[model samples]
Target: MARDADATKVRILAAATDEFAAHGFAGGRVERIAARAQSNVRMIYAYYGGKSGLFDATVAEALRRMAENVPPRPQDLAGWAGDVFDHHQRYPEVLRLSMWAQLERPEAGAEPREIYEDKALAVATVAARPLSPIDVLVFIYAIAQAWQLSPGGLTGLEEDPAGGDGVAARRQSVVVAVERMVHAQP
Candidate 1:
């Protein structure tokens, strides 16, 4: 039945997410994904065309999940930053996978770039009418990456240092600062 087929596809995708998260695309094996999904290799190819297609699907799905968690809000930069910071904490693997995709093939990141640009433009709409959506997107992502990496500051956002409350506060501060920079009145 169509329902059965859909269920199988979902299973494969879920399994693939985990496998790919643990291992980069070059390292991920189809057999491992099939086994984890409790399905067969044939099913994966049938539904996703091939490993490349599956990887693209997985990347798209991860971006979709992030978008769902952080909806577009022109005046909710703090909330959006928190959502994104938390998303990175909860699903760091997604970030790693995306990084891998970018390093492996820059073109592969185009679709996700478009998704992020559209979402960011919606949030930063109050900025100068001619704001480059790509710039806004890069700014948001750069902030998130800085917070996540925290070079000389916090290590991991989830693990609050002895006294530091959490990464949320630090992230909120950065978000507000960036908002001012992006939406500054001309």
Candidate 2:
């Protein structure tokens, strides 16, 4: 019974991720998420309280998945940044969800604190020189996600009009930038 309940929750979260990514918090429809998850509205409320709760849960789950799958490797910041870029490309929904959270729900609860602490420690230990771990992490994340979030704004000005390999080029640019940032003196 517990297994079945967990499955139902997972289904609901997956549906909510797609719904929120497409429509955001204000525009997202709980009824649609229920339909997509094959679960009723009451069940959503029972599990997640309401639309806000569901959104929070969806974002939390997305972050958890990313951390588990693409944890930062401070010793290899460039490789880690490349992996992050790939993950963002593959799971663009996560980035969309984050954007919505920032724009629409700035007051939302912070990301898991322990994750931040662990990442900071890892980065501090392997840093080439003294640097704020938080700053390094933020820099790497921004470089990796900037293109995905705003390709036209970020890469359009300088990129060739007919560049067929934009993604590859941007990814390499991100890795190089991360390497430089990690190694540069504060």
Top model number, TM-score: 2
Each candidate: RMSD to true structure? 3.5, 2.5
For candidate 1, report its TM-score.
0.80
Error (Å) of candidate 2 at residue 184 is 2.0
User: lDDT per residue, candidate 1, 4-74, as tens digits?
Assistant: 88788889988988888778788899999999898999988999998988988887888787778767666
Error of 2 at 59 (Å): 0.2
lDDT of 2 by residue, 21-136 (tens): 99999999999999999888999999999999999889888988988999989789999999999899889998899889888887876256677788888888883565578888
- Candidate 2: worst-modelled 10 consecutive residues by lDDT: 155-164
- Poorest 10 consecutive residues by lDDT, candidate 1: 154-163
Tell me the lDDT of model 1 at 150: 59
